[model samples]
Target: SIHLLYTLNIFEFSNTWSLTYFRPTVPTDLWDAIREVELSWAFPGHWLPSKDPVKTVYFSAGRQQWIETCGAVTRMKGLQSFTLHLSGSWFCEPVEKIPVFLEPLRDLHLRQRWQLNLPKQPYYVKEIRNIDGDLRKRGIECSIRAV
Candidate 1:
C-alpha cells in the first residue's frame, strides 16, 4: 500500500518519493532542512508502479489552501479512494473544481480540526455547505467528522 502525505508545503509518499510542490509559508531554514532529509531518503525509482498498487492517500491542508492540487489527484489512473485530513481552517471551492468521477472512491474519509464549509444555496446561507451535494451527485458515500 502506498501512502501519500500532502501537507501545506510538503508532498511525501510512502515509497520515499517526495517533493516540495509549492512554497510553504514557513521559515526558509526549516523548509530547507526538511526538504534535504526528504530528498536524501526518497526512493529514486518509478512512481505509481503497476505491480505494487497504491492503496490509500493521506492529505492534510489548511482550509482551502491546496484545493487545486488535491483535485488533481483525482486524475490518477488507479486511485480508488482517499482520506482527507483538514487543518488550520475550514474552506470550500466552487462545485466546478470538485472531482466529478467519484465512482471509484469506495471509502472517503474526511477528518477535520475546524469547521468545514461547502458551497451553499441562495449563494450565501451557511458558512460551509459540506460535501453532501457533490458526493451525493456522484453517488459516493463519505464519512466526515471533526478530529
Candidate 2:
C-alpha cells in the first residue's frame, strides 16, 4: 500500500538523515525537531550514547532513547505516560554513585541482592525515604512494594 511505502520511505529518510546529519553540536532545537518525528512508527537514534549504559536487577542508570545513533533519550521527551521496560543486570551504579540530577525522576524501583552481607546504610535509606516523602507530600502516590 502507498501508506506503508511512504512510511517506509520516511523511516529510511530519517535513518539516513540521522546518520548524515545528527551531531552533538547540531543544537537542542535540531534534536527536538528530529524528535518531533513520528516516533511510534519510526526507529531513530543509532548515533548517540545512552544516558545510562548499564543495568541490573538492583539498578539501572542513565537514559537510552537517543534517536540518531539510537543510544540516547530523544524519544523520551514530552512523553506523559508510558511503560518503561528496563533490564536488570549486575553492573548498575553503586548506591554511592547516585548523581545530583536524580531528583526529577518520579518513579524508582530498587531490587537488591538477597544474599548481600552488607547492611543498608543510613544515607541510602535517607535518600530513598526523602524522595518518597517528597512525592507523598505532593500526593503523587508512591511506594516501595515488595518485588
Candidate 3:
C-alpha cells in the first residue's frame, strides 16, 4: 500500500486520509531500507498514556525526534513492513506551510505541551510565546508557541 499512499500524497489524499498510524512508527531510512511498508492508515489497538493524543508509526519514537532518529537509526537499515503514528500540530509550528524538500516524509506526528522552565536549550523561548525558526537547505530555525 506504500504506492497507494505515495500516490495519494502525489495526488490529493491529505484531506481524505485520516491522521492516524496503523503500523510501526519507524523513520524513512528504516522504512526505505526495509523496502516493504504496510500502509494501514488506521488507529492502533494498543492503549497509551499521555492525554496528549499521538498517531502511531514504526519506530515508536516521538515525532519530535524523527529527524534525529532518521539520521542515526543504528539497526534501522532495512525496508519496513508496517508503520503507525499520530499526526497533528504540537510544540513547534510545522513545515507544511512551505514545501516538503526533506526526506520522504509521508506525514507529521506531533504533540504540543506548553511548559515553562523546562531543561531545553534555545536561543530565545518563552513559556507562552510562539517558537520561530528559519529552514535553509543545510539547516532550519525552529521554535515553539502555545497558540
Cα TM-score per model: 0.27, 0.21, 0.20
Cα displacement (Å) at residue 44, model 3: 20
- Which sequence of candidate numbers ranks them by TM-score, best first? 1, 2, 3
Better of 1 and 2 by TM-score: 1
Per-residue lDDT tens digits for candidate 2, residues 11-117, read 22233234335446444444333322222212122222345533331122122212233322224332222222111221232433222212223232223211111
Q: Per-residue lDDT tens digits of candidate 3, residues 23-114?
A: 24644633334433222211222222234445344224433343443233223334222232223322243333322322323222112221
RMSD of each: 15.5, 13.6, 13.6
Native-structure RMSD, model 2? 13.6
Ranking by lDDT: 1, 2, 3
Q: After superposition, how far is residue 21 of candidate 1 from its true place, in Å?
A: 2.3
Candidate 1 lDDT (Cα, 0 to 1): 0.32
Model 3 stretches astray by more than 4 angstroms: 1-64, 73-75, 82-84, 90-95, 98-147
Off by over 4 Å in 2: 1-78, 82-86, 90-93, 98-127, 130-147
lDDT of 3 at 145: 30
